[model samples]
Target: MDRTAHGLTSLRNGVKTLPLAPMRDNSEIRTLIDRVLPVVDEWREHLTVSIGRATELTGLKDTQIRYFEELYRQDRDPAASSGVTRSYSLTDLRRLAVFAELLKEGYRPAQAAEIVRSFADAIDYGAAYTVADALRREGDAITDGFLLSRLASQVIFAAQREIGERLPDARIIAMFLVERRIDGVSAEEFVDIARDIATHPQNVLVAVDRAAVIGNESDSSESVWSDDESSIVLFYSRDPWSVPVPDRAQFCYYRPPSTPDATVVFMVESAGYRSIPPELTVKTSARDHLLDWMVRMCLSIFPEFRQATRAHNYRYRSDGYRLAHTRQSLTRLMHRVRDLIFGDDADVSVACLLLPDDLYKPMYLSILAHAGYPEARARQARLMLYGEGEGLSGRAFNAREPFLTLDAEQDLRVFGAQDERCKVALAAPLLSHWDTHPFGVLYLASQRPASPLWSETAFVALVFGNILSELLGRWWLTRLRRKHDNLLHRYVAEYIRWFNGMDMHGPEFNEGLQQIERIWERIAVTSASSGNVRTVVERLSRQYVTLVVLDIDRSRQLHSRGDEPFLLAAQRHVHQAIAQILPDVRGYWFKNDHTLLVLDGYAPEEAIVLIRRIAGRVQMVPVVIEGRTERTTVTISAALKSLSYQELYDLSHHDREVLRSSLMTIIDTIYEQTRGCERTIKVFQHGVWEKV
Candidate 1:
């Protein structure tokens, strides 16, 4: 998935990799006037012309056209406007021209006007609500940092949000400009895969969900994405092979006539597939600007923002405090957090924190980064979720200094973890920016008791700890920058979602997404905490996502009552319960306390059914608390938020901002409603909470 983000296509069978198009300058304004305007006649209804030009087309004086309009209006037929602009269209002029012809044939002005109204039946008017208008409007309205032609930008925007409205999956479109062949599948087999997905989608570009990352999660190979065609698109080039095209394919070969050796795309009915007219089609008689536009959009998204937002090259694993080890996507400084945190020094009794908020604070430690270590010590240091001032790591973080204890076994401060078996322990603070708050501590304990080399080892650990701190500072900066860049991508998507059916050729059209991204890049060019893309996407869309929170009621109290084992067992049961209920619904677990499930493509009713099923499982499964068997219902909070459009929303801040807000509101409602108890199932719908 390295190249998968921002529509950068993954290399697969018969997939040719070409550098995508860059964002073009204001010269793009000419694209509409020169190419699409003259060619895409459907664009004419959305596009408007001046009155002087209308007069020229109709061969009538301005006064005469006004007189005809007045006569029609007196009979309650006023000329229509383009909505944005009150200007007339070529259709109006053509209608006028036809009316003048009738007048020459001795018909009254009212009769001529009535005759002009049936011009579509009399003349060849183009398709309405074509994909071209969507493309043209999205492209023209969004003119900044956008290079792909109006056609391409809209295509990319439409690829999922609009076009996917008709599609079966959230397929990512990757453009190919060169002829290539599928390595294993023959042309015929390729058709079968597209027609039926009978074989693995390895032959196409599919984007598997993070759930697809399980079991084989450690395998970060691009091949894993082939499991689902729901989000992959292998865009082909024009006339590249003799393979028969699959009906209703997610992708089609496209090459604009402006390219040097651009040959006509043989069978691609890019626009016709959608029942749009030929002139308003993507592979219309005229098309290069569209190629540019698609490339622009697929460019890691203005992919120059890749220049502005340099974190795209790194896979994100840190959002919402997710941990990473060797090969997991983390900060560049700790490109391999496992090396020092869980690396070669594995045998030396090393323990690292889990879920460090901004510095790995507020959590526990694990010494065995891998399995099959000494079972006794492994169990001892398995996990000790403690308070901020409890563990030696927390002590170092709070005091802002390294801690070294030569006699670790008898040190009461060391806690009774198996690591206390060691004679010496060293702990150092993993520093944060400005040293405001230290988040995590890196701790080490010796396997041997009271060795003379312990002092020197402590000093070396202190020195290396500071070095890691400096690297983490850089890592934090990179993260915030990446966060902002990601927000921009969301804003672009949000604005387009709202603008899909709107007129782009109208006056007063503001390129909100483009302008915002441009201003954000310019303004926050250096700040760690920059602009909020969430705030900008607020009014653009009311995204439809169901937020579900499942937690063990009174988890903190249960943990304090020596119910750690109970809570852990409950988590396993909940995980099993979900797998049994709706295995395909991907849910993200947080801090082992609660599970955050953002359900996309699932109805609120189905999600509630799932919650009830999970509640049944937790209530049915007995756990030993205080050596007594008891079953308790878990606390479940669920809400379904609806949007006006279709979007492939995921679990990233990009799509989760609104969900996050609603999640907070959901939690808040539970706090107020369940003041008397800890367990309850609450669903927020139609602005009311339903308790089950």
Candidate 2:
């Protein structure tokens, strides 16, 4: 007889003899030992069994056995000879058994393979040490029915039970099948039924009414079964040799009360089983079902559909409904993505959206959500965009790409020095919609160093970053428009107040008002011509302007210091200090060590006095350069220029030429007086000024 046919024949013969044996404990032990010992002996010495024996033992077909062997071979070390004929060891047989069992339980081959691989190492170790030693130690007494069953349970079901324990979904399904077995069926027989279901095609037995069976068989209807109205159809394969089928037909199997629930067991070609329906034939896995549900959920929230709804004017609901729906959909998507990537036990310390300000500094980050941290601690979290060169978020922003560190303490250069909370850190740049350069970063941190979120959350975060960018962009545009409108409104209101303040009924009031209107028109024209509002406004508001020349004393000392970095920093500090004192004053760096300060609404003498006070303050404050404090004073020289509305209005058309000539004369006299003087205070009065 053909080996393949012989293996099938042997399996059939074994099934036939199962019922013929008497129900004595000794007989049961003798029966199991008779079936199992020979197979054990074959693998005991060399730790391997022939493919045919493995096929018969696992109840897997020849092709299925070959496929599993191929998978095992791929997992083996590449150094091993590929030309060697295929063989199965105690380890290989256990994995094969699991793979076959899952297949029989309606899992697709790929799904079964993935699940089996998860526990394959554990199963191999258990088989080698636990089962092999037990078989050798027990010897002939293994035939004692109880001892035989116990050994079988330990060796055969140990890995499966461990797998079930690790995965709650699998445990629930196993418990349902075990608890719902027919009355009088022994635990051993029920286990045999489960094994058989795993090895053969079976009828799917969904409840006729899911509501009626709720909370009875499974915790929830969605757990083990899917339902549709009119009839709760069970999906199954008609041919015993074929793969488990997708949900297509209502297949029912009739069994006596003495038989296990056909809903949970395979339909065997025996006296107790009768198949009733036969159209279901293609295979699907739990993962496939989940993917299908995810697809449906994603499709329901299509952008086109949402856009159409947002554009439509509905009488029943306000426009806010669209925003509410978008938020709801995004929340759902976040939850789903989290669940898929992190599993149930993941702890996400924080999720933040980092944005850049107009200065290109990452000043702060907006917290989206966080877990495993107290509300106070979460609220206290601060992210500095600039000068945070040592952190993962900073690195991501600088690099304009994603960054991940599994063990932040050991792997990261920044953040780890001061922070003990972060174990895993991941950051992905949030790019602008119009450009490839990143405008912000999406940051995530976790206490669990080994969490998969570091690797798995990058792509999803990129997608989310793009979505957030689009949303924030829309909000910013609206805010800018509102600000522009408000600025215009304020300008109009100020103009009206200036017009209304005039005494219209007084003598020459009309002429004065007409002159003011022309001045206003000149101011507007100058503002438009120069593209400077502050310049035009100042010229309109002030009759006189103070020009103060500030010369840093011994500034050449900085060049002699020979430390470029320190010198640059010290210069910046001085400039910043001066600007801080008079924030509204327009100033320019006329030279490396000199600044020209332009002040409106001050006379030359008053400006000179003010400049002296500012100079004293600048000398009093010391600047730190490379850990050393250094003090520097400024020499002050002031000049006053009259810039009345009438004068400005007349000069408006000659704008640059007249203003340049007037400014040059004032600047020249002050520069000449302050040329070689240090700590000098002088005021220009009637073209020539005296030193004070």
Candidate 3:
């Protein structure tokens, strides 16, 4: 997985180690133009010289062509005035060329129009809705061409969305064009890509429900129940070698009854035979970009925001206060008081007094008068919530040093008042850009008295307030820059997901590249581009040198041994042996109670020795697989030159057949020789020849 491992070893090395294409620039735009001009010239008649010419050739009325042209034109420029004679640029021309190719490939004009339109929307919006809308509008405007176009366009859009959702930026989307080998850029191919991406662990891309992260529960009842009772249930039915099954995250506890109804009851089930279960497809597929953003917000941006919000609500409840009203009033009062005190510009401060007009004087008096007590003050704070008449407001000029007050009672003469009843406060000068000395008093107030002791809560609040101010100041300065970077990363990651048709956020880049190679094995890239020979070769070779080792009669014995531990121990021995030799050999397989492999990496003579060693060593001791491993090799080089999946399959089948024949022939020969030896020994015992 090293980044530098796949660098250029030679100029002629056509296989580029799947670098995610960078976002296109002006030069790439020019390259696209160069690729499309020739197509345009050849399809000139079908395309027409201008919008007017196209209208004439297609026999469409002026209005129809205008509608089509207008659609294309508007998309070209968002700010352009409608109905202006906006010319089609090279990019537009190239897109038209692709549409023309589809038409020639048998799409009707109307269908072609729909398809082109949908594709345009998908490209422009990066979603499938645009195409869906266009089809809906096509209502009864159907044609063979239109149908083909519609199907093609619809498929492309869906696949693109599927891919784009996984990788959200532009470059990854473009890279998909080059990497994915789906048939004719169709939707099914994209779906296949999406499935692969979803299953591939290296893709690291995950989707989560945003509502769930925000504490919103799923509306479905199944979400709260065990999976067996839910829509999908995980179970084991067949051995791993029997089929290529999707992996599961864990084993199932509730095994369904062995009946056909069981499968119908559970929409999905997963299991493993000689290996561990595979990953869950549905879980991975459900994860998308919004969820990714939520995860980043929670884990990356501010981990404690959600927790703090919850904790604050709990604190309010525990204090016998209605948090909703208290919070609402607090917020409203903060803004209002800020405006009243600071006028046009209000600088944020560590602490400020927020009080209703009616209770201001009473609360202030209670703090400094004979009624001053922590219990009484706390009660008055709650009574203030009940709306009452307003209190008097006054302004004084030429005041001395500013002393803090709870509400309206401003008296600093009695030092004993600074007890639990009247929480102590600090008054620091607020200086702004316009002045150097104190412009206004900045107050810090807490519930704990400062005479001789302070409450634990008050001390904590003091520390918290200081941290908040410093943190907020730093946040204000870097918010814009952080937002920009986050946005860029989001788009790029998404674009790559779209390009690969899978999430690639899980592992580092190199691991993903290896995963991509694994998926590429299952698909065929039809693009006649360079650098695909090695990939094709690797895929074909897998089929040519495949080996299949049949258990012969050991299935029951292994089953009797019981549980995964024993089976795994046996499997590990075989797997380790296979793994060590496969690199030196050509092909290998492990499934069911059989070991099937093909060797093309080594010469025939060398392959013989390697295959024999694998066969002989596998049956060594306590883990007995028929007490002897079978070896078979077929020369596929003559028949499988231009290799393919099907051809590889045929080659493997052919080799297995030949191996079966060899086993039968050996068995028959041994039987015949033993029969003759038995007769000779019986005759010798009866003294037919000399007894020496």
Instruction: Point to the candidate with the largest lDDT.
Output: 2
Where model 3 places Cα greater than 4 Å from the true spot, the runs are 1-58, 61-576, 579-587, 590-593, 596-692
What tens-digit string does per-residue lDDT give for candidate 1 at 1-692? 12322322223234544433222232332221222222223335446666676766556787878777764452322565444333666656545665666566565555455444433333335223358745654454244222222223234333333333443343333322221322344455533433332122211211222222332233323131122211112221111122333344333333333342321111222333343211113422112354444443444333222122121122111111112322133223232332444345435543443223333233444431322235355434523445445666666766677788877877766755463466666677766643565534557665555443266766766666667556445444444433433333324432232233133211111222222223233323322253665653452234334556566667666542322245544555576677778787544444344555555445666667777877777667654332233454444333333222122222222433554444455434433543344556666667676765
What is every candidate's alpha-carbon RMSD to the true fold? 27.2, 31.7, 30.4
User: Which 10 successive residues of model 1 have the least lDDT summed?
Assistant: 311-320
What would the TM-scores of all predictions be? 0.31, 0.27, 0.17
- Total backbone collisions for each predicted model: 13, 6, 37
lDDT of 2 at 576: 59
Ranking by lDDT: 2, 1, 3
lDDT scores of the candidates, listed in order: 0.42, 0.44, 0.30
* Segments in model 2 whose C-alpha atoms lie over 4 Å from true places: 1-337, 345-350, 354-362, 366-368, 371-373, 413-423, 433-439, 446-451, 454-460, 476-485, 493-692
Better-scoring candidate (lDDT), 2 or 3: 2
Model 1 TM-score? 0.31
lDDT (Cα, 0-100) at 310 in candidate 2: 24
Question: Distance from true position, residue 383, model 1, in Å?
Answer: 7.5
1 versus 2: better TM-score goes to: 1
lDDT at residue 152 of model 1 (Cα atoms): 31
Q: What is the RMSD of candidate 2?
A: 31.7
